[model samples]
Target: MISKSTIDQVYETARLEEVIGDFVQLKKSGANFKGLSPFTDERTPSFMVSPVKQIWKDFSSGKGGNVVAFLMEHEHFTYPEAIKYLAKKYNIEVEETQRTDEQKQEANERESMYLVSEFARDHFQHNLWESELGKAIGLSYFKERGFEEETIRSFGLGYCLDHWDDFTKAALEAGYQLNYLEKTGLTIIKEGAAEGESNRKFDRFKGRVMFPIHSMSGRVLGFGGRILGNNKKAAKYLNSPESEIYHKSKVLYGIYFAKKAIAKEDNCFLVEGYTDVIQFYQRGIQNVVSSSGTALTPEQIRLINRLTKNITVLFDGDAAGLRASLRGVDLILEQGMNVKICTFPEGEDPDSFAKNNSLEELQHYLQENSKDFIQFKASLLAEESANDPIKRADTIRDIVNSISKIPDTIKREVYIQECAQIMNISEQVLFNTLAQIGQKALSDAGKKAREAQKAFEVVKSEPVQEKIDLQYELERKIIEVLLLYGNEEEEFEDLLLRENEAGDLVLEPESMAAKVYEKIFLDLQEDEIELTHEKFRTIYYLLISSLSENEDFSINTFLTDLDRELVEEVSSILMEEERYTLHQWERKDIYPKEKQAGVSQLVSETILTLRCYLIKKRIHSLQQNTEGSSEDHRETLEEIMNYLQLNTLLNKKLNRVLS
Candidate 1:
């Protein structure tokens, strides 16, 4: 557990712009920094970072929070992990409270697996550096591959000694439970023990060079190992088996290292192997990652979709491998990303190609040779279908199917036109095929939705009534004003509307000055009203207490004291306006009203409307009671009539026409 003082210091030291800028490409927009959302795929920017408020909002996804919360949301970091990351980034020493044995045992299973994987990574790294056999074999292999000594260390490349029991014994000696080690796929425990014999335990990556696969936040999730010696019985590369914390299909190699570059370059280079990513990265191509030889999954594509919508896939020159990987292009397109295929010359892969050429030559070749998915697919398939009309027809359909996966109508139309020109087909034929595909897709979707609705209806038999709660929105608005302008003293005016002797409504402006929070608090209390919503009520009390105690308002301080959910709620309120860029109505010869110009009237009207709602509810309750109990009927009727008159007058003051 981190101490409160340490958390506060860390929050105060970490700058919001600097922290988010590491993961996003933010350009200045007015006083704030704006960029495409890292949470969703979009071309126009909807993510905003406010330096003065020390918060960020992704209007596309409705996610907003301070720096720590952003890390937690974007990288899936736990609270302590996020704080530790910030502290490390800003070079602040962290102080944590000592935990008891019970607290230590309370860690969940996934975290335990992470701890075990981390321990294994450190143990293997130690072996690579300090052990004679590891140095002679694992270190020799990496150096022979032209990997720099610094690169080897930074990527957490390591070695496991050939002796079967070496890593397993060290892990046990260090008090790590065998169960966790086995669960992480670091140590394999054989089943069906002989009589009077302990179950066999051995290292999974023995006699291999290790590469630690990390999550987006840089936590070690698993390891991929390359065999160092001739072991025909074993596979050349062995990866950690599926565990609680490691899913190969969902994890992309080197995302932790390449995310920043991908965002900056606005393009990601996708390769096939781990070394391909490392080699490209070492040669100054930083925006690259590998699928670790697994078939690409939608989850992995969505991972890349977070940083940018442009992917340039680097394929090996080998025809077999290239053909097998071409399907990934459609998957990328289906996720609303633009994918281009870049194939090296025969007998060269990304690793060899990057190593053989200068960085400039490699980059120029990539820029000049990369082809869009439609062009690449047609050209690649055309060579095999020459003079075979049937094969050519099938090839055109395949291209059309890929185009149909694209969600953007304009992009789809453009691709279809390009495909028609390349394949020497009529545009009408392509259009008919596209329409058929789209109609089938819609029919399938409708069928699935109907089935889902039927299942939901069977499980939920009762009708649920939802109330139109006006007070909740009004209460939230009041909190919004308090948080945004609480300490700023400003002039406020209310419009006094009344019927003059000439029987016409006249508006009179009355002005006064007060701190924003003071006026809001006094007005609500004067009307004998309190916030009714539970979350708003809690926030209201906290705000008042903090103001009275400190005599100042700090958004950062207020957020630090809030729980995670409350932090999200408060940030949502503060960032709601930034969700859409403000339009310049005046530019088009139209001047719209500004909320800032009439803050006093807005606050007064909000309070008055709330009071009117309360009075109407009271009158309704009195009428219901009067029908059941006639003993106090006259009193109830008199009270209800007076309440109605007051409600009517309040509505009149609000300039609301009577219905």
Candidate 2:
């Protein structure tokens, strides 16, 4: 655990602009900086960073936060990872609280599993280089696959020894718990052991070359291993079992390495195996990831969706492989992403094809051969159906089903037209089929919604609270004043309403001066008024307490203690007026007044308006209570009249005409 003081130091040392600039190209725009959003592809600059408030907002995606949040969102760093990154950047020595063995043991199960899996990756890599059997067998196998030493190392390729307990023993000797090893499927414990005998545990991937699967942020989540020898009884490839930290359906094999390239190229080359991903990467085609031969899943497609909307699936020319992976195309379409299909020459997989060609030749071939998903599907399925009318009818319906998965109407129509041209079917027929599929989908969705509605009973909504917009607006304005000009002292003329000796109320302008915080606090205290909204009251209390404790208050320092949501709201409030770069009014023959010129009046008027709004609400409440015929009904009527008089006076002071 990082010490609180160290976390504070990191937050203080890291500047929002400087931190976000490392990943985003920002140009100075007035008091803030503007840049293209890193979250999505857009030509316009909508991402804004404010140095004064120490926050950033990506207008395009509605993501905004302090410095630490940007790293977490963009780099996918965890809280500790984000903090450590900042500490390293600012050259701050992090101080950690020393934990006992009991505390260490209390670490969460998922984190422990991650730690164990990472250890396994490192252990296997070490074995590949240092163990005699690993080098002679596993290293030789990778080398024969045309994987260079650097490529093998980059992907964390390694070897597990043939002996059942070799790796498991090494892990136990290294002080790692066997429980985690078993949970990660790195070690398999034999079931149904004989009496008086300890349950036998063996390595899960012994005598296999390893491929470490990483999360988007490059943390080792799991592993895939290929057996070196063709043992007729054993599976050729094996994967880690689903664990707390490893969900096979949710992970793609090489996403960590391919994310940036996918974003840069505006497309991704999705293959099916670890070797295919590695070989393509080695051949300078870095934007490629593999599903590790599993059926394509929606979760995997969403992983690609984060980087780009375009996916080009490379298929082996073999008919069986093509047929097996065809379902994935529909999954991609359902995600609202553009998908293209490319088939290699006969008998060549992506791995073999890339290995045999130069980088230039491979790039050109992919560019020239890739076809729109619908076109490719129709052409391929048409050939397979081949003059069989009933098979061809099924083929058209299959294509229509895939088309129905597309969310865009225009794209579906375009696909239908293309299919009609290729299959010699009417566009109207395809459109009608698509409409029926869509209608059925909507009906199923409606049924699910109804079922869910029944399962979760709908609660009655609470009565609407009557909102006083004027009061709410004034409350927000008061907070804005304190956040912007609280420390500044200025002179202002406040109206004094009094009964002169002439027996009539007279208004007099009285000169007064004080710090904004002092003026606002005294005014609210004298009026006995509190901000009605819970969020506003919380902000007000914190602001007053903070200002009282420190003679000189720093908004940036104050923000470090706030949660991300509050920090964003406060920063947004402070920086709202500065969203568009400050304009040079003088150049346009108009002189603009500085905020300091009106600070005293603004602060004074904001407090006065809030007090006036509160007085009116009190008067209205007392009048309503008088109708209840309580024992104090006459007293309530009197209070209402008194409040009404005060409300009138306050309205006069605010320069509003009586209705």
Candidate 3:
């Protein structure tokens, strides 16, 4: 268990915007920050973060909480892991009690795999720096590639021994499980020949250099190993197999290091191999990542999309390789990103180019040589289809197809014009092709929709509309008022029932000054009314207790002690009205009332509305009881009449007419 003081320190030191901003690019909007929903595939910004409250909400997914909750949701971290991450980020020392063997073993499969992978990374690095064979072969290989010691260490480059079972033995001796080792693809286990024989284990990356693949938040997900020797049958580069924690298509190499720089530069430099990414960063270009030699994936693109809308794909001089990589540009375009392509000269890749040139030269080359996708694609294709009318027509259609992938109509049109000039074709021809492709895509989508509809044909009922729960809403409003203005002192009008001189029972209004929470708590207690919603009831009691006990209570600090569900509830209640701020209502000359200006009135109305609702419910129950009971009904009827009069009087005080 982590010490409570450390947890409190983390909550105080970790800024919500700064923590979430590492993963999602956030822009200032009003008093808060808005960004594309990291939880959902969205083009519009709906994820909001309020630094004042230290809470965040994803309107698309309905997930909201404080900083720790965001980490748990986005990074899939355990509670302790999230706190540790924050502690590390904020440079705070974590004071945690040691766990027992059983407690350590109780970690889930995914977490165990992560642990194994991290251990493997450490073991490999130790081999590179400490072991004799590692220093000669692994360390030598990195140095020969012009990677300095710091560069090698920063990327966690390491070497695996030639002996097949050396790593497996070390892991087993360290009390790490062979199950997780094999699951993470660090160790390969084979069954023995005989029943009594033990299973044999081998290091999967034996005789290789290791590169640890990390998640965006810097957890070691897996490894990519490059073979050292020129073995005829062995694959030159190998990656950790798909496991519970590592998915290559979704993971981008160097993202953990490059995320902040990518956001800062407003552009990501895309390369092919691990060395390419490392070399560029070593050359002082920090906003670069690699695809790890895999074909670009939509998931990878979305990862970059979170940081910036611009991507510059760096390619080698190999003609075939360059042509093969063009497909990734279309993927970037489909995600509504601007893509520029840059290629090194013949016999040079990003790794060699960065290694040879100074930082200024490399940066200058990229700026001067990077070409827009339209110009690059059209020029590359025009050379192949020179004086060939049929191939030219196909090339025109191909360019239009790539343009169609762009989501912005203006960008698509602009690219079409550029393609017309490059390919010497009419702009109309490209637009017509674009329209035809779009129509076909729509037709195919419609067909899929109709086929999906066929599966539900037996269910002919219309979707049920949910009726508004007035009591629940009123209860929610009461909680909201208490959370917002609980400690605020205000004058309130108290309604007392008295007999008039004319012999009629009437409401006598009197004035009293009390805190908002005091007024709400007293009003609810006087009526003996409790919130019906379980969540609301629990939070109500907590709020009341907290308000009464602490003279210096803060919602942010109070939220730290609650579980994720309760924290989410409180955040939703507090941020419910913040949605209206996103619309910039004042900019349209439409001024809305501020809740803070009328906290006193808001409290009184919420309590009065709850009283009226409860009274009406009681009257209804009494009326129903009188209908079927054979017992005396006069008392019930009179009780209903009295409740009805009280309900009417409360509603009138609220300026609500009761029918």
Candidate 4:
């Protein structure tokens, strides 16, 4: 359990822009910062972070919240986890309450696995520094490879002892479960031995250097192990097999460290090995990640898209696997990501070049060498053809095919033109290829859409009953006013438009928000009634608190001071509105209506008061409908009578005010 005071400190100390800016590239726009949606693919920026309110709203996905809530939503951190993340980011010390034994036992299975993985990482790291064998084998191995001690620690490198069962036995002894061990592919559970008398525990990676693969949020989902001995019997490297937490196809290694750099560079440098990523970062080219030598998948591409749109893939120049990896560029194009390919000089890969040169030199070489995938492919194919007519023609079509994978219309046309010039082919030929591919893509999309609709027909076709209760329409209206224009000054008709004693009409300065809320409060108390909707009840409670607070009306401050759940509700109400605070129509320099200022204020006041009155009427009706038997109906009758009198008075006041 976390203390409320600690949570408040974390929230108060964590700046919205500072926290999000570490992960997202936000450029200022008016009072907010806008960036591409991390949750969806869009060229135009719809993710807005408002510094004044200290909240963010993604117009595309409709997720909006304060900093802690954003972490919970964006990175999938739990409430406490998010607090800890913020605390670490801002250097705040955490003081968590001790958990009960039962509460510890009741933690979710996934969370337990996460804890075990974290423990394993720490144990390996500690061993790497403490044990003689680990220091000699693992630490020395990293040092020989030119990795600094800090780099090794940063990447969580370690080694497992040669003896089987060492890691498994230790983990199990530490109160971790064997079931999760086997599930996470850290233990080999055999079926034939001893009729299931322990199934024999053993370490997955023995006599091997460890490289723990992490998620973007730095959770140790799994690990990749590299063998140290000359074991022709064992593979050179092995990774944690797919499990409940780790999916190789979806997880890109080094994204945890590289995400901020990727967004800043506006390019993801995709390498082929784990060492390639580490070496590049150590050399200060931090905007690099490895495919882990696996064929690139669309899921991995989408992960990159969350951070940036441009990806530059770096491959070994002398490697035999170039042909196998060329397919990734097309996949990148299909996702609408701009991709370029940089093939290093012969006998020099990213790891080698980075180790040999300074960061600036290596970065300059890469920048000068990188070519758009289309151009690189065309040039490579051209050289391979050596002007052989048939191969040359095939090369042209292959380049065209790569261009065809691009999704944007303007970009496709431009690439087609570029290809025509490079290959000396007609633009029409390339455009024809692109049109064919584009039409096929559209047909495929339509087919998938139809299939999805069929699969979800029950849900999609179900009738959507109107959520608005007719009796409570005015209640919601009042809520809308409080949510939107509650702080605006307006004229309140004293006694609801009644003439003054001097035979003249006059208006009074009464806060429409306070007056209507007070009326609703009084009416509810008189009938001993309650708001049906929990969210509505929360909003009503907050409104009462706002009234209870001293004057200096501040919608922003009131909202910022709310609890997380109600903050979300309030933000949804406040931000969904498309208001032109510019007030362009109000300025006389442009155009103005007669007495628009006072009339507008008066009209807003009437709307709010009327809404409160109607909500009160609905409450009365609900009270009447919810009455028990007429036999013991004295209190019920009294409630009905009192509600009717309140409703009639509110109605009269509302009509007079509106008129």
Best by TM-score: 3
lDDT of 1 by residue, 1-659 (tens): 78787788898899999888776778777678888687886656788888988988888787888998899888777788899899888888889876544553466777677877887899999988888888888888888887888888889999989889888899788667788889999999987567877788999998889999998778899999998677799999999999988999989999989989998898999998889988888888989999998999988987787677799999888888676788888889898889999999999999999888989999999999999988999999998798899999989988999999998999999999999999999999999999998999999999999998888655646788988788788888888878877777777664455777986556566887987777778777877787888888998889877766666668888987788778888888887765544333457877654366466666777777888889988999988887756485787788988787677777888889778
Instruction: Indicate whether candidate 1 or candidate 4 has the larger TM-score.
Output: 1
| Whole-model alpha-carbon lDDT for candidate 4 | 0.75
> Per-residue CA lDDT of candidate 2, range 1-659, in tens?
88888988987788988777655556788678887677765546678888987878777776777787788777666677788779987899989866454553566676678768888999999999998988999999999999999999999999999998988998888667889899999999997568788888999998889999998767798999998787989999999999887889988999888877887787999998999999999999999999988899987887777567799999997878687688999989987889999999989999999999999999999999999988899889999899899999999999999999888889988989999999999999888998899889899999999999999789899899987689777888888888878888889777777888986666678999888888898878877887887777888888988887878787866766667667666766666655444344557887644466488878777877777777777777777666747475777777777667767777787788888
Query: Cα miss at 472, model 1 (Å)?
Result: 1.5
lDDT of prediction 1: 0.85
Q: What would the TM-scores of all predictions be?
A: 0.88, 0.80, 0.96, 0.81
Per-residue C-alpha lDDT of model 3 across residues 1-659, encoded as one tens digit per residue: 99999998998899999999999999998889988888888887878899998999888788899999999989999999999999999999999988665665789988878877888889999999999999999999999999999999998999999998988999888778878988888889899999999988899999999999999999999999999888989999999999989999999999999999999999999998999999999999999999998999999999999999999999898888666779899999999999999989989999999999999999999999999988888889889899999998888888899999999999999998888888877889888889999999999999999999888877578999999999989988888888777888899989899989997779998999998889999988988997899999999999999999877777877787788889888888888777776667899998767666477777877778778777878888888888866899888888887888777777778788766
Better TM-score candidate (2, 4): 4
What is the number of backbone collisions in each predicted candidate, taken in the order shown?
0, 0, 0, 0
By lDDT, the candidates rank as 3, 1, 2, 4
Candidate 3's displacement at residue 580, Å, is 3.2
Q: Which has the higher lDDT value, candidate number 1 or candidate number 3?
A: 3
- Report the error of model 1 at residue 125, Å: 1.6
Per-residue CA lDDT of model 4 for 1-659, tens digit only, reads 77777777776777888887766677776576777677776766777787876777777777777887788777777678888888887788889877554554566777667777886787778778988889989889889989998899899988887788778888877777777778788778776656656556678987788899988878898989999999899999999998877889988999999988998888899998999999999999899888786789987888888678899999897857786689888999988889889998899998988998998899899989999888888888888897599999888878877877777879988988888998888998778877786788899999999998888655447677868564354455456555444444444443343446986443333444334445545545664666666777778778767865636554545654667677676666555432232233445565433234443344444454544555566666767676664556666666766555544555554455323
Assess each prediction's global lDDT (C-alpha) against the native.
0.85, 0.83, 0.90, 0.75
Clashes of 3: 0
**Comparing candidate 3 with candidate 4, which one achieves the higher lDDT?**
3
Count of clashes in candidate 2: 0
Clashing pairs in 3: none
